[model samples]
Target chain A: MDWQIIVDSIPALLEGMGLTVQLTLISLVAGFFLAIPLGVMRLSSNVLLSSPVLGYVFFFRGTPLLVQIFLIYYGSGQFRPVLQEWGLWEFFREAYFCALLTLILNTAAYTTEIFRGGIQAVPHGEVEAARACGMSGFTLYRRIILPKALRLALPAYSNEVVFLFQSTSLVSIITLMDLTGVARVIVARTFDVYEIYITAGLMYLVVTYGILWVFRTVEFRLSGHLRDRALDPVEALKLHP
Target chain B: MFDLKGYGWMLWEGLSITIMVGFLSLLLAMAMGLIGAWGKLSRNKAANLTATTYTTVIRGIPELLLLLIIFYGTPTLIQNTAERMGFDIRLDFNPFIAGILTLGFIYGAFATEVFRGAFLAIPKGQGEAAYAMGMSRMLAFRRILLPQMWRFALPGLGNVWMVLIKATALVSVIGLEELMRKSYIAMGAIKLPFTLFFAAAMMYLAITAVSMLGQRYIERWANRGIRRA
Candidate 1:
């Protein structure tokens, strides 16, 4: 009901959005790059390679992201001496670094499973055709496997993106001034709880739909060939094998 | 290290509350999911609109944001509105109650889709057959449709459960004495943050692993006598 309070808090909340956006993007992009190789490696017959990746994905997926964030941020402080000796303390010491690392690793683990499923979902006949053309190793994956798999992974990846964006709120518990943290601080300052929260929730709603819109557009483009395009029933039957 | 610096007992207690909250929320979610699915599948435009809006709004926001709003914002709004109407009253919610309701309401949106899919997966002929056998509508739904719907709904419901259990951790933010909160308290007390959090993480993983096993067992039972393609 108090418009003035929400109006006054806009600057701080917008500033907090910067960190929220940064955290989501950094985590998602890093997770995507790491997941590509991990996805391929997971399907390999070599137990030594696949098992570790399997364990990594299992551990991260099985546990909550909050625990992962706390473990990295607060838990790492317990090993300050060792980190200090290895020159890694500088990176682990900051809350932002710990939060970012946690987000990246958590997303990477989940995305690996999605990407692996995508790879497996890639048609067996397509792989066979690629092999018949002597496309092996890098050529096979790059030219045939990865492309189709990435398309298959898009919808799941979009879900992950929404989850990751929302999960970024967990970083606020670690003292980062992200959007949720900013809203929390304002609510504590001005007792207009509904106004502040409603504002933040609206902002989140807008961003969520925006992300979905982008994904929908991309999905349509990627899978366009699979959809029918106004062909007559008899003509469509003729095109079918 | 896993002794949790002698604070293991507290973790055990917290785990009990966490599981309690998880199940209670699951119960509420299933109830809402069923109602929402009914509204969605019904021919009434108003019911369909209401169901769509509920799922859309909840899915758009983060669970923590919704939990915080319900825990802190709801009572304030109620008090404000009461004052404007010339009534003086106070309302406060226990964090436990707030958490269960918020999570139930949030995940219910997801469960709505799952239930709707399950309902649609059943062939219309099954219900028609029930009616032809002189069964009432309610009896047909209860005896014929519901059991078959479960078989279709299991996998999606399992996914919802996994997310729900993990989501109960967010209740710690509202000061609920769940596993995550207890671990935080112990971390502050013993200063062995790594050991305490790692133990909590392992406990959570154990719960999820056990849930997965139970899910698989139930999946087998629910799917008994059905052939897979």
Candidate 2:
């Protein structure tokens, strides 16, 4: 490994880190909101609303993120005339926005399912007791249901967040100069693929490790009220970015 | 507003290759997953560490990076090793093999967790009871452990299978004629990216729906005894 070359490229690579964090943070925030309604629909008794949501989750989860990105970026481009007429062309024209939209929708579909599991895991007795206390509708969901589901869902949600962070690298293909993109650009110039890639890999390791640390601290704080705490540092690292 | 007039045959061709790659890699991933699960669960510390590292590194590295490394770096590495050993061989990697290896490596990491969880779910006393009945270790594992583990692992394994099926699309970046690559070609040829890509997405949805049905049947079969009870 050429240590000097890696040292020289850090500034350029760090520039791409902005895009990486941007994609991850935006998608995570968007996906969390999107997942709530979609998750409720997935568990809904009504088939009309639920089925479409089910189909959406199936479609997104079943296809690769790369294909979805291609479909959104290239596929949307083919509909330029229609998009222009509808005044939506501006949104699709920006690769960064399109990539963000894809990641948001894709992660939302998966997180919806995860959250659905969490919602279902919420004990029925707790809901009934809350209802007996006269809570209903949004009040019921906001106070009684959402809090319990979040607690149940935190572990899986943490993993999803890490996966989303790692997945931001895919945006590089669509012309967003993320970390991976910068590394590739450096490789094309320097022709030293291994050193540059190792640098990128190490960068990911650091980011992922940081994510793992945050999750552990949060998990530890969350379990502070519980009787038995079983958060293993090593196991917690697996959930890191 | 959709035009499917001229690209019918080409779409079918692309779908076939996509299915081919997905199935081939599915088989390879399953085999690797089994071996990886064993390696992870073995008593040997080195085996456990190797499996853990393999899963962690492979999972952390983006699929595109792995494809790029194998495609560009593997050949160079092979050529250099050959030169140093006084061999006049210029080694070439098959794209299909590379695709399978990459997918297997990715899915094997997930399968290790599924299989480990399943093995842990099985009560240890069952294995002890089997041994007390004069059964060999292998036989005890085959009869007492494997069946129950499979049942417990089916749901998790199913999720991994779904993940692997989707991940196969990444292999198209390496110039493979899987559905995504084929759709790209058709889109390029006709200048209608939406139609071709939509058709490709539908094909993927069809495959996904079918596999889900397959998973349902496997789950049913695995739980047959429990259902009867």
Name the lDDT of candidate 2: 0.81
lDDT per residue as tens, model 1, A1-241: 8788889999999988889999999999999999999999999999998999999999999999999999999999999999999999999989999999999999999999999999999999999999999999999999999999999888788888988998998898999999999999999988889899889998988998788778777777766687566334333221111
- Chain B TM-score of every predicted model: 0.96, 0.92
lDDT of 1 by residue, B1-229 (tens): 6766579999999999999999999989999999988888889999999998888788888888898888999999999999999999999799999999999999898898889889989999999999999999889989999989999999989989999999999999999999999999988889899999899899999999999999999999998999889
Q: Could you tell me how far off, in angstroms, the CA of residue B92 lies in candidate 2 after the best superposition?
A: 3.3
Per residue, candidate 2 scores C-alpha lDDT tens digits across A1-241 of: 5799999999999998888988899999999999998898898899998999998998898777988898899889878999999999999999987899999999999899999999999999999999999999889999989888987788788788878888888888887899989988898898777778777877886787577678778877777777266657565564232
Q: Which pairs in model 1 have colliding backbones?
A: none
| TM-score for candidate 2 | 0.92
Where model 1 places Cα greater than 4 Å from the true spot, the runs are: A229-241, B133-136
DockQ of 2: 0.50
Q: Against the true structure, whose DockQ is highest?
A: 1
| lDDT at position B152, candidate 1 | 90
